[model samples]
Target: MAEAVARTSYGRLVARLARRWGDLSRAEDALSDAFERALRSWPGSGLPDQPEAWLLKTAHRRLIDGARQSGVQARAEPEIERLLDELTERDDPDALPDERLGLMLACAHPDLDPTLHTPLMLQAVLGLDAARIGAAFLISPAAMGQRLSRGKARLRERGARFDLPGKDELAARITPVLDAIYAAYGTGWDEIGASESRVRGLVGEALYLSRLLTELAPEIADVWGLYALIAHCEARTPARRDAEGRFIPLSEQDPQLWDAALISQAENALRRSLKLAPPARYALEASIQSVHAERRVTAETNWLAAAALYDAMIRHAPSLGALTARACAHGEAFGAERALDSLEKLQGQASEYQPYWAALAHWSARAGRREDAARAYDRAIVLSADPAVRVYLVKSRGALLR
Candidate 1:
């Protein structure tokens, strides 16, 4: 019960506490203390009838205690007095005002480093640890941890407002919020774990944030396009692994297992985004998914359409991922030799990237370069973390040996 509350309500609780205490770092510390106490006490006392409320109350007390110990109680008296009054008036924890959006915006404040915005939001709003977030951003865990700590300190120093930005400021702040959520979703997509947080992952959390963004910023085309992209990817998740749990790449997945309703929702979202403006990076990516989704009814993948969408997306945001994807799509639509040539050009830039090597292996095999294919497969397998993907790669490499 305590664990579940922490997972679902951590952000809401932290947001409220930070708003009351006027300190993000302190709020997090107090909440962490509350959770630790709960773990020790709950096992003995059974359980609190209102776990979230109990947590909020306990953390609030901790904040007051900390303030008094630090000899700042007099200076913090006004905020404390306001908090005391508000706590008296609010009986239900569920009625606690949700300030998560404001908190997210503050984490993405204009004055902070733009690059740190997403990482900060991932840590503060989502409760993702630095190691996980660092993996997503390709930063060292220690470096990411230092960056997040510095971000919070910067927020405190700047006295970043914990309120919704004005209409004019909304557009400027939202991009990083979207980026953070997408990064979390990507982390969830590739990972499978035994821990509760890991097993639950950020996929559902990301989807919730995506839906909230659409409701909050209906005019933003990128917001809707991102939603469509995530939904389309999620719709096909059930087919990404076989019954035996081996990895199944997208092209070979059984469309019958795909969620029709999710596909429909994604298509509607894509339409809404395209109607608002021309196709951008995410919109083009969603269009590629839409083309892949057509195989459900059409029973044939249109590599040509997918290739064209990839080409357009590269023009908009020539990210390494997009470039690598373009090479794959172009190879499928054109020829394996052409794909190998394109991937070769990315050699120095993509030397450490696992997907590049994986794609190289695939194209190498198709191009009848057995030795090069085997070598690429070896590199891909070494770089891969997922057991299922490693298994699949091993199988693919074994076939080449035959």
Candidate 2:
């Protein structure tokens, strides 16, 4: 409920804070104080008649208090003070939504560490709870709490300005925001736990942020392309695994589980992305998903074509994730030998190299090499920290025991 209200009323909330206090810092101070008031008063009061109005009212009052304490107008920033003074003062009043656009720019600060920046945006601006945020990253809630605290302190020390970046710089900065969200989605999608809320939330938030970016720069194809990539991934999320929280390879997933509506939306997003000429990294990734999407069923999937798509991707981005995805395809199509040859070069590239060894285990089992399978499975079990990897261990060792 809090997240919904925050999302719905974000622009207005941001604006009123700026209007009352001028600039981002005091506005955030006023808003945070108002939030504290909400926490203290709302439970008993049963929510004011108009929550947005109540929040705006509380924010103004807090701004006034802050000004009194600071011995200056909270609206003291000269240019905006006049705008502030022109407003009528009253309890539970309504004002235009805040400039969430500007606030997004502020939140996407290049100077701030990218690691904490996305979570900070989720916490401060979107009002997501720590559990949800932590779940997004596949981390313990305690770890998330500590991380967010450290991030907030760093942001404070840097004293990031409440301003937008120039076009090129803004384009560069937006990538990290999207990257963090993508990282969250990746971990959460694989996580074998009941708490999948964070993954869903972060994926939703990432797409939202990308849309916001597109509005700010319609010419930025990468933004729309990113939207396509995430949307495509999200379209598959509900069916990515099954009821038991096990990893279900896409080949084995029921086609009916694929969300047709999301697929259609993703297709449109991909086309919208092409409007900017040569496609970017996300477009290529989406293109790969598109190949999978275009397939009528798993057997009909173009593994060779998919592998080629990944090869192009590697030439451009050269990440271990891309390399691993291709290796999985190789293992599925030709045999384990081909996959093993492909995975060997990626030893130092990934810390979680267990997936590669797991692939080897699968191939060893397929080749009926019991000893090789057991040894590879042992290495895989050691490398894997995630529970899902245990399934490979069981299958491989079971082959030997049989």
lDDT scores for all predictions?
Answer: 0.81, 0.65
lDDT of 2 by residue, 269-352 (tens): 789888675766788888888887776354477778777777778787877667777877777677777777777777676545
Q: Give model 1's TM-score versus the native structure.
A: 0.81
What is the TM-score of each predicted model, taking all chains together?
0.81, 0.79
Residue 305 in candidate 2, Cα distance off native in Å: 2.4
Can you tell me which runs of candidate 2 are displaced by over 4 Å?
1-4, 11-29, 35-54, 72-98, 135-150, 156-159, 166-169, 188-201, 211-217, 243-246, 297-299, 330-336, 349-351, 366-370, 382-389, 396-402
Global fold similarity of model 2 (TM-score): 0.79
Please give the range of 10 consecutive residues that has the lowest summed lDDT in model 2: 187-196
* Model 1 CA deviation exceeding 4 Å by range: 33-58, 68-80, 90-96, 109-119, 128-147, 187-201
Error of 2 at 199 (Å): 4.5
Q: What are the per-model numbers of colliding residue pairs?
A: 0, 5
